[model samples]
Target: MPSTTPAPSDDQSPASRALADAVREIEHHVATAGWDAPVRVFALVRTQAALDAEPSLAAQLSPETLAAAQAQSWHLTSIEQEGLPQAPDLETLLAGLSWPATVDGVAVTAERVVLPPAAEAQMPSDPDEALPWLLAHPDRQDVRLAVGVLREGSTWCAVRTRANDSDDQVGQGPDVVPGLVSALRATLA
Candidate 1:
C-alpha cells in the first residue's frame, strides 16, 4: 500500500515568493534599460506620507520604527549589472568606504562569496581583518555571490559560479552570509 501525498514546491513559502518577485523585478528593469548600463543605486524611504499615499504598503512598513514623524532612509543597489562590481572603478570606490548618516540599510547585487560554516567561524571580529581573509581564501576562486540587506534585519544572498550556469544559479535567501552580512550590517548599524 502507498500513500498519496504531493511534494512541496520551492515557491510555496512567502519568503521564496518574495525572492522570486524581487529577482524578476530586477531582471525586467535590466532588460528594459539594455544590458550595458551601469549599476544604479536607489534610496529606500519610509514616511507617513508614503504610507498614506500607498495604503497597501502599510503592511510592509514596520509600525514600531515608523512611529516617529520623520522619514527614514535606506540604500538599495541595483542588481541588474551583468557582473559583480559593475564597473572597473567600483573596487576603488568601495575601499575604505563609509556610508552616509542618512543610510540605515544597504542592498547591493555585487558578486559575493558564500563561506562554509567552518570558514565563517574563522572570520575575524573586525571587518578590516576579515576582508583580507575573504579575499585570499582558496574557495573564493571563480564564485559569484550577491547580497541584500534591510535595516530591520532582513538579509538575503545568492551564489552560483560554476560550470553549470542557469537561471537557478542565482539562488536567494536569508540563510546565506550570516557572518559577512552581519559585518556589513554593522557598518550601517
Candidate 2:
C-alpha cells in the first residue's frame, strides 16, 4: 500500500515532523519499488548529554529534570520503512534525532515478519550471526518484516495482516516476531 505523508498541519512537534519525513521518504521508495508487504518501523534513542547538546531542546527541559540527569531520553525516531537499508545509517540517524533531555521513553509500531516454525528452527541462535543470514534469505521475500527496539532492550515486531480501517496493517504481540525479536535483542546485547 502507498502510505501518505503526515500533513504539515498535523502536530508540529519535532518528533512528529521527523516521523512524517520518514514516512514520506519510505512511501516514496515503496511507490517505486512496490510495497509487496506492509510498512516497517524502528525506534531511535538519545542520551541525556546528546539531547543537551541541542539548543532547540533547552526550552523543553525543566531545572528539576536537568538536576536529576537521567542516562537516556526516551523519544522515538522513525527509520524509513526500508528496514536496515535506509540511508544515513541507523546509528547516525538515531544520533541526529535531538530529542529533549527531559524525555526518557519511546514507543514504536512496525510491520513484522513471522517465520514459519520450520524456518525459525533453521535460523542461527545468535542474533549477530542470524541478522545477515536472515537478510539474505529467499524466504524473507515472502513476508513483510518490521522491528522496533528500545534502548532499554525492549523489542517488538509485527507480522501478517489484520483488518483495519486504515490502509496500514497493525501488528500486536503474541502473533508478532518472536525469534526475530530475540535475534535482534541478541544483536543489541
Candidate 3:
C-alpha cells in the first residue's frame, strides 16, 4: 500500500521534469516495497517559475501536452478514484509545517495541531490552556493549529485534523480505516 509523489525526468523542461520526478519518486517508493494494495497519494509539481507565474496551475494538469503526454500527466488524477487521500488544498492562512515523529510505528510529519483525547476532551475550556502539554514535546511544531494522534484500538495514527472542521479532508475516517492503517505500515518502513 505504499504510494508516492513522482518527479518528472531530468531531460524534460524544468516544469515537465518536476512533474516526472514526482511521478518517478512515488513509483519508485511503491515498487521498492512491492505494494499491490491500493494507496492514495497526492502530489503537486511545477517549476518554481511556473508556479510563480500561474499559481492556479498548482492543482491543475498542464494543458499544452500532446495526447500521450497528457495521459501521463493525468495518471495521478486518473488513479485518484482508487481511493487514496488527497492532501489538503493549499491554504493561505495556514503555514505549512513539517515535524518529525513516530505515532505508532509510522514516522512522518503532520501540520494539523491537536491534543490527546484526555487533554482535549476533559481539561480546561480555554484553547491556549492546552499549550503547555501540546507544545511540551520538543518534536512538536509551534503553530496555531490543532494536532491529532488517532488511536484506534491498539495502534496510534497521528495526523493534523483540519481546524474548525469536524469533517476529515484527507485519509479515511472509518470506512477505510483498515486500509489506511495498512498503508501506514508501508510508510513507516
Candidate 4:
C-alpha cells in the first residue's frame, strides 16, 4: 500500500529554512568531492553578545557556528578586515578542539583543518605566489583559511574554493585573497 505522506513544506521556520537551505547548498557543492564521511555545515557566532542573543529561531549550530557570525557582511568590511582570520580558521587557530559539540541540546560536528604557523609562514606573499598551490588543494565544503607567519609576525586568510576547480569552487563571488591578506596583515600588525 502506497501511503501518501506529504513531504515537509519549506515553511518550517525562518532559521530552519535558512539552515536547510545552507545544508542543501553545501551538499550540492560537496557531492563532487569523493568523501565517504559525512560533513555537516554550521554557523559559528563569534562574540559573546552574539552567542547570547543568537536568534533563537535562526537555526541549529555548533562550535563551528562561531565563525559565520564573525564574517564581515559587506565587501568593504571584508576587505577592511583583511589579515583577520574568519570562521574557517577557528579550528586551526585553536588546536585542541574536538569533533562533536552540544549546542542548545543539538549535537553537530565540524570537519575542518588548520595550517600550522610554520606552514603559514611559507605561504607566498604575492597571491600569485600562493594562488596556484591554493587551487591545487582538496575540495572541501568546510571553511578554508590561510594562516601565515612572517619573520616580524604572522597572518591568516580565508582560501576560497573556486581558485582551483571551476566547477566545485565555493565562495567565488568575492576576492578571498583580501580577507586572507587582511588576516595576515593583522597577524603581523
**Structural similarity to truth (TM-score) of each candidate:** 0.41, 0.36, 0.24, 0.22
Model 1 scores worst on lDDT over the 10 consecutive residues at 1-10
- The lDDT values for all models are 0.45, 0.41, 0.31, 0.32
Q: How many residue pairs clash in each candidate at the backbone level?
A: 1, 3, 21, 20
lDDT of 2 at 90: 34
Model 4 stretches astray by more than 4 angstroms = 1-10, 37-189
Best by TM-score: 1
- How many clashes show up in model 4? 20
- Candidate 2 segments whose C-alpha is farther than 4 A from its true place: 1-43, 47-50, 56-73, 79-142, 160-168
Pick by lDDT: 3 or 4, better one: 4
Q: Is candidate 1 or candidate 3 better by TM-score?
A: 1
Residues 1-189 of candidate 1: C-alpha lDDT, one tens digit per residue: 011222124545433333334433453343344333454432223344455566676576466545542332221223222233434553443342345664434444344455677877888889889989887876653344444455556555554444334444444556555654665565465
Model 2 vs. true fold: TM: 0.36
Index of the highest-lDDT prediction: 1
lDDT of 2 at 188: 41
lDDT of 3: 0.31
| Full candidate order by lDDT, most accurate first | 1, 2, 4, 3
Model 1 RMSD, rounded to 1 decimal: 11.4
List model 2 lDDT by residue over 50-100, tens digit each.
355675664665765444335213333333323344434433333334323
